[model samples]
Target: MESRSKAHVSWCILLEITVAVLFCSNAQAAPLKITLDTYRNCIDGSILSFSVSCCPGVELDLNVTVVDFIPKRDRLSGHRIRKALQCLTGEELRTYTEKLTRAYELMRALPSSDPRSLHQQELTHCAHGTGSFVQDGLKADSNFTLDIHSSWIFLPWHRMFIYFHERILQKLLDDPTFTLHFWNFDNGLDGRTSSTEGCSEPGHFFPGIYNDNSTSTFEPSRSNRTRVLNVPIDLTFPVMFSEADPAVALRCVNEAVPRNREAMHLAMQKGRVSRDFFGIPFRYGDVRPPMLVGGGSLEYFPHNSLHDWVGGFMRTPLRATGDPVFYPAHANVDRLWDVWMKLGDGRELLQPTDPDWLDAEFLLWDENRVLRRLKVKDVLNIADLGYSYEKVYDASWIFWQNSTGLVSSAMAPTQP
Candidate 1:
């Protein structure tokens, strides 16, 4: 009897040791480097949205040289003001799977009522609620909705959401540097506006990472979620008001069809000013304009179009976050803002400095799972939050399309 008890104790000890080793091995696993081959599974899993900062990538060496040319915007901007990582390339998306999966898992794991949770009922309310803080007191009424879309809340609210989302992801992954990749859908494989890479258009290419049943990044949706949506990311996908002329889509076969490169040119060139791209910084005047305060060209075209193109579960804004692409897609839009701001030596394009624009408020979950209210002014500089996107025009080779030298799309020069 004593021998039998001793043997059982030994077995239990062995099992515990095995678990410890597995945890250590997984935790200490060298950070995966972003590579073209890497994303074939999760590498290019069409993140279309976000990741953690301080994560591994090919930017280390270049950081040595370019840190000189890159102006030090702020002590903190160094961290938060990340160059929205473009999803056009597969690298960032591949390395980000662990972080992305962990974030989604944890958020979903939380109770639905928690503002951070992504459960259906809560998301449904928020969607109809538009942009709002569903806390006590102010929003006591069940039907009291805060439509934060359009005008000012658009950029600020989204930024706050992305910030909390990124922070939550960082916690789940336990890596502060984890960051999200912005879907640079407009740019092509070569980071040139004119290059024609097969299935490489922003609207085309689906990250095969998510399609594979084995990958954590994959999210099963009715619309062959894993299959790449080979069409161009069409900005003219929606007809807006049923009454509006469908013919506004210049060359599309049908109102619902995707427009060609010409449509992209119009979206960029016509709204060559700040207010046009970002919309009036503050949309809430004395009389609140109806929801959808006439989104700017940026919001109307690339932003909305990408959401529609990544259809199925993500077809509607309410359920958009259900798909991972939503993050990188918004990151791409944010990157465009950076691109636009940097044009003509940074003076040409700039967000509004009005107190209203700066003082905009939005609610998001902090790392502690507590609901935190953040002002639009607080998040303007991502670097303050501890990350920055890869250098815009001169991004590292991690985003290269080929062996020689090629930058990714959506990040191509403003000029043709």
Candidate 2:
């Protein structure tokens, strides 16, 4: 009996040792996940949206306000600005992004996920409550029903959303240097707009590899068919936004769609441009009144020239929600504006002759009855904004010039 008891004790000890080893191995093997704590350390001076005179080693801790996921009816109708204020506080934004970044990290860590996978999921599942804005209950036509005049609201709304998400990442991972990639179209290397690249299979970067299972359905009309090239970075990536490294940011920028100048020119030449408010479509070519150009009146502004202007006009329900690329496409347009401002000789870019286009009343941020108008020249230098972005292609590569005079639809090889 004594010997049997001793043997049992030995077995139990051995079992405990094996379990300990197994647990340690599993802990070591697990892929690194982006956590809120990790995000905090990555904060850098570049991520601050507003100006700060004094630099501190620790970021300003956010003051968060908890509210319902959606705004209350009274708040939505009665005091929209106040409600917006409730939603737009620093803490709320940080929490929102932290959750989003966590979701992205989870998706990325999955065995077989990629940018394409995330896109398909966004269209079908509405990852960010984007489905709330979908009018037709169809994922494919998400951006189709947006109101044109709501550019004022939509721009701020999306920017706020992005900001909130970024803040959450900063809070979680403790990284401030982590920044976002603004899609640039001015140089025209984006994969989406360029026919030389397969418009349907747009590229993206993942911190790690995963199997891509997303399916693509092709369409003939640019509206009916989704263009994959120049597709925006999936709002979802595995890393917390604050934890994302410069390389990751660069990859996101590099994968964006290139602008299609020919397509844009043809669309404009055909007089398909129109304007709208909120989600409702207005009269074609009548959105903005004639502006003085070279001491004469002109209906169209050179700055607004792009293929999307045509698509923006001809489509009914002028605001687009069905297209996954809409936000990114607009972002690319904004990026081009940023790039052109940088390259167009800073002083010359701000000479606003068009009254409709260059009105002083156009305010980027309005608080306390003080309106701040953003000049075309002021945005020309993003570096002055304390942020610089990576170019689409490497500096060593030859610039892509559309001098062929022939439009060919083929996927071009991506420059490494």
Candidate 3:
């Protein structure tokens, strides 16, 4: 009764908020004109500038100014906007699979020592190894290990990693327009805007595009089959996983839709600042590994869940590259970052402006076969990197920010 009552009230609130905020005056209302440079701050408007002192020193302001989403007109160049593709249908999936296969074939043909070599690149930049932290001309203490996961560098590091990988596939295909597809498990393979459940499975569970071992792009060394027992590899984050009981599984199945939505919600809505959204804040001149800090809600939820579900080799932090799906999975993660950036009435959603974050640098192999150093601030704009994701999703996701657990609690599956 308690659960049902809560659900009933929430449903009413959802309908009211959706009607008022989403529909505005008429049923066919335009997207709220974002008042740029304006912030819809909390009543007790205050923030902690995680700059010189790390994450300390709160300032109460008369108003808040969020990290603004820069308009295209203000950009220097927009020539190479890479579209992150989605495998919504067989034809669409096949197109991406074939292109990815060809790229893999060509990249595998490159000599191992060549920076552009597929294996070499993954190991050097992504996978963990005996000498993972050692880069040319850059030295770290022998005991120091560079783990992008659990560290503040996770976001920017993977951003560059996926960008470079996309470039490799494009160059090898000899098609400047070639781009990678994203395994959008959260939105399902059909990739529609329906707020329905069961889309994450059958439709996307261990996506068929990456599961078939016969394909060059679908590696089999470590995968779903080998996933550790009792592990929630196939589960979406914030939708916690359990086993041994059909009732539990069913309950989980029921909540997947809303929790998945809510996870995206909290990652974007509650995680308003960089320290909150990206992970722990990195301080200026900070050369040590992140101690008490962990990943942000974004990284912990869908991001890590995708990696876990793509288990086997993907389960390992440093060696998941063997699985071809890693790129597409990260592409989806990257897409969400763009999605978060553009969400809200150009008001609530924001990014961090800490000098440590903006100035952070990582390395990657450029398309010219040269080892090039890239900065975190450089890849802020996908167009700047010569890529842009296909505009997907309608305004439905924007409506549920105020939906406080309407689906997760009462929707649990019960035994007959």
In model 2, which runs have C-alpha deviations exceeding 4 angstroms? 1-176, 182-328, 345-347, 350-381, 394-416
Candidate 3 weakest lDDT stretch, 10 residues: 38-47
Cα lDDT, model 1, residue 383: 55
Between prediction 1 and prediction 3, the one with superior TM-score is: 3
Report the C-alpha lDDT of model 3 over 1-416, residue by residue, as the tens digit.
99999999999999999745421223431211112111111111111212111100112121323232222432323455333343255676577678778888888788765566666655543322212332211332322223455545667667878777776777888876776766654552233435343222222344555655676676666544322332222334222233333433322334455555655555555454545666654332223233223566567666665554454556544356656777777777787777777776542234656555666555455565544545677777777665666555423244446554543342221100
Model 2 whole-model lDDT (C-alpha atoms): 0.26
* Reference-based TM-score of each model: 0.59, 0.30, 0.64
lDDT of each: 0.44, 0.26, 0.50
Compared with the true structure, model 3 gives a TM-score of: 0.64
RMSD of each: 24.3, 27.5, 15.3
